[model samples]
Target chain A: MKSIAIIIKKELRRFFTDRRLLISVFMPGIMIYLLYSLIGNFLFSTPQSQEYKIAVQNPSATFQTVLDGYMQSEEVKDTYSLTVIESDGQAEEKKKELENKELDLLVIFSADFDEKLALYMQGVKPEQLPVMQVYYNALEQSSQSIYTIVTTLYDAMESSLANVFEVAGGNVATESDGFAYMLSTILPMLIMVFLFQGSMMMTPESIAGEKERGTFATMLVTPVSRSAIAVGKIIALSLVASLSGLSSFLGVIFSLPKMAGMSMSGLNIAYGFGDYLLLFANIIVLEMLFVALVSVISAYAHSIKEATAYSTVLMIVVMLVGMVSMVGTLPSALWVYFIPVFNAVVVINQIVTFSVSALGVALTIVANLVCVALLVLLLAKMFNNENIIFGK
Target chain B: MEEILRAEHLRKTFKISAKQRKIERTEERCKVAVNDVSFSAYRGEVFGLLGPNGAGKTTTLRILSTLIGADSGDAIVCGCSVRKQPEEVRKHIGFMTSELKLESFFTPSYLFDFFSELHGVPKEKAMQRKQELFRKFGIDRFAEVKVGDLSTGMKQKASLVISIVQDPELIIFDEPTNGLDVLTAKVVTDFLIELKNMGKSIILSTHIFSLAEKICDRIGIIVDGNMIKEDTLAAITEKRSLEEEFFALYAQIKGENL
Candidate 1:
């Protein structure tokens, strides 16, 4: 225990003193905040334009009336200035124009649009009878306006036809832009990246760097147990990575609203001291797991460069997994709850959305602890292996 | 005299994969690295294990220090079996290697204190030991400088100070002065002589035969994982000069091979 404490102190001193490591930890969060804020400002402040070329297919008089009404609406007039074409082929031409940066969007009205419009309002949704298809090649600011215009037109047509057909009003739900949604989509990926990056960049240097410098051999000859050395490294790395992870979490929470242009009035991100402590505890366990895994990776390599390469590949894999989890819902499985990186990502998402279950939190904590334990064991085993320690 | 360190038929073999002949179409196997060997060092003596690179000098030292376990032999250090009581063996020895580099982030004083504490020396004792070593090695004048910023000689002095801070019964140094300049090497050599006078058992492994002649009470010349010669310097250099005797031994081994 004493030896482990000493190792931990030494490691902490090294970490605090290394300028490169200190910069890596803080720079990512600052850059992320700055980039997000700039992008968000552009998203919210930019005016919508409707220089979109759209095609009308065999337009009837009533269809023309509806189209003209949309063109005249203040929201539409403020957002878009439309150019109507004759056919789908012409719409495709407009799509090519948009692809070549000539147009913003392309809208196609199919031949059966009038019939489909009638059916769409009469409570019979037209899946194949395409009333309009808007195409934008990229995620541009104007695309949001295009989506808004299309949805508004569809809703108007539906309500009018509902009156004629005497059908029940189909109330459509709008998407939420509050804390829960933001937490679900962005927080998990951010946490995973922060934790993984911190571990990848710090843990290897703590172990393999020592070996490369020849300090590890000197360390082993001390009265320190192999287990103690491993534990010390794990603890020091966990502290560093967890602190960086927390910094990143705060960066996202504070900068996200400004970036997304979403109202922060109803967003209750202000947590009590107790909530902060709990969050910190979770992050600590996750950091320990990642750090231990990195230590094991460091032991596998003979030099700092080799260790860095191995750790980079591992971080990329973790990031890819975290990203996939962000874009989709996590699978509910007991086994999934046991997987280290994946479990951390899932729990972080749940935490952000304020939907974390007690069972899930407990499971995640236990899973991470298990991972740390196994990795420390592996490291200790490696330390005892003559081939590794003696560099044979 | 009591044996401070002992290895009996110590062996370590590493299997290498090779292509098999036509009939088997399987990977053949060959054993590489350390083979069976044995030697012992008595208390209060400097024992030299002389070998060129890849002659298993480091491997033998690792086994003795409990850094690694031998494949099929037993080593005892300070009366503790390395195979069964490695922790105890580790507590009795200090190890330094030429490849082991100092952490540049810490001052010499802090580095010594850190290791003293790791060895479970009391805080007051650790401080006293640090101060004493700093003064004795003349490291006190620059004890506050980060090790990385220090000269090579200073770094080596710092390394030795940390290694001996625990005052273990046995010390193992593998090519401890391999890269030092003449002045730094003399300082290290003088320190080793001082430690010897204090009755510490030391094992110094090096390919430099002259280093062994200077301080070693006994020398074991190892070649191809085998100890070809083991004796006191006086006995080995009975009539011939140390250099001539070393060449004669080398020539004898070469002639046997031919």
Candidate 2:
């Protein structure tokens, strides 16, 4: 135990005293915050809408009154400027203008449209109503917006003329609930990725770097057991890597509002102190598992560069597993909680959305501990293997 | 004389990769690094294994130190079998070679204390030993400097001191002065003599005849994974100088005129 503590102290000293290593471990969070903020600003700010041009033939006073009322009420009169023109039988030409982008939309009605509409409003069901032909270029954004608004207004008017019953209180979800749902899908994946990246940054340097520099051989010659060395390294790496993971978690928490174009008010992110403690405990154990697994890979590698290259494959695997949080729902199968990286990602998703179960958390923690113990044993065996340690 | 170490028919072989075969320009798939080699050293004696490069001297030392295992035989160090009880063997021996390196990020003092703790030395005894050894080697002046920032000689001295942190019964050194300046080499040779006078058993490998002659009480000559000669220094040099004797033995093995 004393030997393990000494080794841990030495490793901690190496991590805390080195400026370059410290910067590398903590830089990802700062970068993520700045980049996410920029994206949010760009996405949420409303862009200037272009003025839409519309030409009408055989215009109806009733329809014009409805359009004017809708536009005036919305105070968007500057967005669409309607021009009334008499029927010149130039419908095809006007359509050509719309396709050419010169006119945003075109509206045409039959010559007796007012008479047909007046009969229809008196509860007389006619064989057919006057046809209203609308033309707009779907490729143009302004044209699409105007077409949608005008069609909506016309439909509303038509529905009111034939009203029988009404529907009320359609959607009950608040804006905050919607935002929380959005975050639940993405934040879990981000946290897993950050945790993995943090482990990768330090594990290779501590193990493979020592081998390459010949320092590991020095340690191996000592009377201490190889397992002691492995345990010490895993414990120290867990603490250091957890710091890195926490930095990224804090980054996501503080910057999430801007990224989602919303305020933190009423968001379901408020958890109790016990909940946060559970979250951190999960993080530490998960990091230990990561460190143990990476240590084995690092031990197998001949040098630090090779170790880093091999660890990338693990990174990709973890990323694919993390993306499981973005699915429709977290897996309810009890056996899934026994899987290593996948289980942690699931439990973290559960924690943030306030759906975690004690059984699931317990199973995940136990499974992670079991796997970390196994990997540490494997690492100790590798450390004792002369071929693996010396690359003979 | 009391025996401090023994090797009985030790042998080690390595499988050569295709890439290595290409680089070495050889078709052999396996290389016998050490073959049926045996020797012994006693208490309060400096036993030197002298041989040419690639003659398996370092390989023999490594096997004895428990860094690597022999395929066929065993080495007993301080009454502990290296193959059966490697950790126990390690506790009784101090092994130093160019291959073992100190972490450059740490100061010499930190590493010294760290290694002492690993060897399970008492705290006060370790500190006293550290002070004595550091002052003896002039490492006290730069003990707090990082190993990487120190000069090569200083790094070698620090490694030498840390290797003996436990004050083991047997000390195995592979080429103790392979790359040192003249002054540093003198210091190392003088230190070896001092340790010998203090009744420590030392087993060192070297190709330099003068170094072996200067400090070695008994010397063994190895050639191509084979022990060619093992005798007291006076016996090996009775008819010819150590260099002349070595070349004569080499010529006899190669069947060449010299």
DockQ top scorer:
2
For model 2 the interface RMSD, in Å, equals 0.8
Report the error of model 2 at residue A150, Å.
6.3
Query: After superposition, which runs of candidate 1 have C-alpha atoms over 4 Å from their true positions?
Result: A46-178, A269-280, A327-329, A333-336, A352-355, B16-35, B256-258
lDDT of 1 by residue, A257-375 (tens): 77768755535554456555656778788878878888998987888899989988988887787786657888766677787778877777766655666787789899889878989
**What is the C-alpha RMSD, rounded to one decimal, of candidate 1?**
6.5
- Clashing residue pairs in candidate 2, if any? none
TM-score of each: 0.79, 0.86
User: Using alpha carbons, what is the TM-score of model 2?
Assistant: 0.86
Report the C-alpha lDDT of model 2 over B1-258, residue by residue, as the tens digit. Answer: 998999999998988999999999999999998889988899889999999999999889988988888899998899999999999999998988877889999999999999999999999999999999899878999999999999887888889889999998999989988877887677667778878888889999999899888889999999889998999999999999999999999999989967
Write candidate 1's Cα lDDT for B172-219 as tens digits: 998888878998888788888888888899999987777788889988
Q: What lDDT tens digits, residue by residue, belong to model 2 across residues A240-298?
A: 89889888878787778888887656444557887888888898898888888889999
RMSD of 2: 3.9
The DockQ value obtained for model 2 is 0.74
The worst-scoring run of ten residues by lDDT in candidate 2 chain B lies at B183-192
Q: In order, what is each prediction's RMSD in angstroms?
A: 6.5, 3.9
